[model samples]
Target: MDTTLLHQYQLVLSSREALLNYCETIRPEHLAQPIPSYNNDSMGSLMRHVANTYLGWLLNFLQQEQHPYFTEDNHKNLPAIRSMFEQVNLVVNNFLQQYKDDLTAPLNLPREGETKLTLTPLELFTHVITHEYHHKGQLANMSRQLGYIPVDTDVIRD
Candidate 1:
């Protein structure tokens, strides 16, 4: 992997830590409360979904055993969600190490419907990180709707 990409990912992790730390200040119940407009998803569910996307794409490329997405009932709390992301981090590290020599080599996957899916390691990494940040925004909005003011979770902040 390029050192630049690794550095960028570290920045993303910094922002994620900021966001999770802020999430800890939210009411425990709010994390589990379903917000109907966002597909009735609770904040916890969105977090799990983000982790799942990382696992789904990267693990598939690694040809590693994959697990189903975490259930809201089982991982709706802060500690459990944090732990899930820990595992996600491990998987991400393994993926980067495995493809460090050639990040842009195409990885062809089993077809979905009529179209086969193909992506480079870099593309997969980019997708999962961006997906996390996208839903991180949603989590912030959910916190606002639940009556808590969100803090700055941007990649670079003063």
Candidate 2:
């Protein structure tokens, strides 16, 4: 793998691990607590949504594989949430290995009745990572408002 691509992937993986660790710290009882600004979605639901969105992007967009993993309704089930994380991790790792020498190749992501988007694998990786980071921050703020201590690791430290 190119040094730049490897570094980017490392950053993404580290951030993802940190976010998951923070989620793990959440008490099971607090999962159903409603978050501010989000109507009808609890902290747990949001977390699961993030995971499922990544998986969907990977499967439906990147890999062009029509998998029946995520749907609009079932993204919040505990089993689905767990599976989403595991699947995202596995897919990302595998994608990195498979395209280690082709980081510059454009990723032709399939869209629904639309033209595919042109993105490098690295770009897709970064998108997923950054998307997760955005949501994680929201979750952290919700946690704080709920009187919980969230993980406060800086990206530089990871």
Candidate 3:
């Protein structure tokens, strides 16, 4: 593996593990409960979005096609959300393995539409990291709004 890319992978993994640790601390019922008066983002909802993004960016548009969306029923359950998290790891790990040699190869993304943007594998991978962190912040805030102390996870722990 490329050492640089490997470092990125570890960072993503560390951050994700940190997130799961926090999620595990919440009671199952609280995991899915909407943060009252917050932006309607439950931890469950943000996680679903993050999980679905792995499928979309790496598995679908970047690597291969996957069902574009998870069924709505899949949302708002801790176990189900956790399953998605694992699935995200699977797809992303597979992607990096398959494309390690082509990190700079350019490709178009989203769809064959006029508005689609082009980026190399490395850039897309970086985008996924930043995007995950962006929503991770929201998840942390959601937990805080619901009265759970926020956990430090937005940065690489090691």
**Model 2 Cα lDDT, one tens digit per residue, 1-158:** 46665667677667767766776777765666776567766777786777676767766667877766655444444445566677777777777787788877987766779987889877777777778888878878887877888786457763
Q: Report the C-alpha displacement of residue 70, candidate 3, in angstroms.
A: 2.4
Model 1 scores a C-alpha lDDT of: 0.84
Tens digits of per-residue lDDT for model 1, 1-158: 36666677788889999998998898888999999889989998889899888878877434556566667654679999899989888888777778888989988766547566788888888998999999999999999999999999999787
> For all the candidates, what are their Cα RMSDs to the real structure?
1.7, 3.0, 2.3
- Stretches of candidate 2 above 4 Å error? 3-7, 70-83
| CA lDDT of every candidate | 0.84, 0.71, 0.77
For 1-158, candidate 3 gives per-residue lDDT tens digits of 56677677777788788888888888877877877665665678777877787788887777657666765566667678767777777777877887788888878775665787789989878888788988888888788777789777855453
Q: Total clashing residue pairs per candidate?
A: 1, 0, 0
Evaluated against the true structure, the overall lDDT of model 2 is: 0.71
Ranking by TM-score: 1, 3, 2
Return the top candidate by lDDT: 1
C-alpha lDDT of candidate 3 relative to the true structure: 0.77
**Model 1 per-residue lDDT at 49:** 90
